[model samples]
Target: KTRPVLDLRPLPKVMADPEQFPKVVTNLLLNANEAIQKKGSLIRVSTSEEGGWAVLSVADDGCGISSAFLERDLFRPFRTTKKQGMGIGLFHSKKIVEAHRGRIEVESEEGKGTVFRVMLPVGDGVREDG
Candidate 1:
């Protein structure tokens, strides 16, 4: 229904839990898709390196989170805006990111869009070039 765009950038491999990383990305992507109610909207995913962190972000031009929810309810277990959402997706995502000593960031404007970023510390992984 909407355009999907990816602008992934190369980064030195960061050590992360094999299973949990995918789960986090999956949840983010799912949310991006679910946020859009318009047929011509967009969902974008990107990756990059910032300072000493590896960043992964999912953004969507769709109905965005309310400030009240963003400030108080997000990442809290069982507090959901969706009728079907269990609300654990974000809650567990936060836990997993923190377990890796990472943090999650949010940027949203109601009626405009939302961007969710997961920032993780650059792990000690051997460079392939070397």
Candidate 2:
């Protein structure tokens, strides 16, 4: 499978903590790469401004997550599917997004794909850069 091809849209400038935003996106990209079953697997990233929100999404066309894992295990402290360590990336991402008055949304289908969208409030006066 090919890593997801990106289809990024122009995103508006958002009022955000520089450090936390980068960490959030990096965590998502890492997770997308980890989900890949092969080099051909597809992973895509996109950004947009919508209805007072700055939306960033990372999607993978790899093995989709189980509903149980999505519902119960995800975002909980100390829960993990990896062999090496506790699953803190998602938890931390969630916290950071919420700290910025944002929310994380997830969608997945077994054997199909998964998508994680981080939606942050865009200040009323923030303008587009390009």
Candidate 3:
């Protein structure tokens, strides 16, 4: 099992669906875990504030993803790299983020690693880093 390194930073509150938002975190973590192809790999989960957005990022030093798949099929339903995956996790995660008026982004390099970032606007219109 690969253990995740956590860097949970404090941030201003954001408007989010309590139930749906958690699924996004869970799905991203699971995907990161599954991507590991070697022992002693690292998965880092972190939170921070950037430009009035509350960001939650999950990064992994795992098998990574192909540029083609990352660009064309990442957030699409039923597209997956896993043999047993049904592939709805990221699809629903994107929907949930968008529903909260947020956005999701990804960066991956095959044989290197991958990172997924979820960003939502600050609810009270406060900026943590001014």
- Candidate 2 ranges beyond 4 A from true positions: 38-40, 124-130
- Listed per model in order, the count of residue pairs whose N, CA or C atoms clash below 3 Å is 0, 10, 0
Ranking of candidates on lDDT, top first: 3, 1, 2
Mind giving the per-residue lDDT tens digits that candidate 2 earns over 35-117? Answer: 77532288889888888788998998867788999999889988876666679999999999887878899998777878999
Write the residue-wise lDDT of candidate 3 on 5-100 in tens digits. Answer: 999999889999899999999999888888885423889999999988999999998888999998899999999989888989999999999888
**lDDT score, candidate 3:** 0.89
Model 2 weakest 10-residue run by lDDT = 121-130
The local lDDT score (0 to 100) that residue 79 gets in candidate 2 is 86
**Candidate number achieving the greatest lDDT relative to the actual structure:** 3
Worst 10 residues of 1 by lDDT: 121-130
Clashing pairs in 3: none
| Model 1 regions more than 4 Å off | 38-40, 125-130
> Candidate 1's error at 30, in angstroms?
0.6
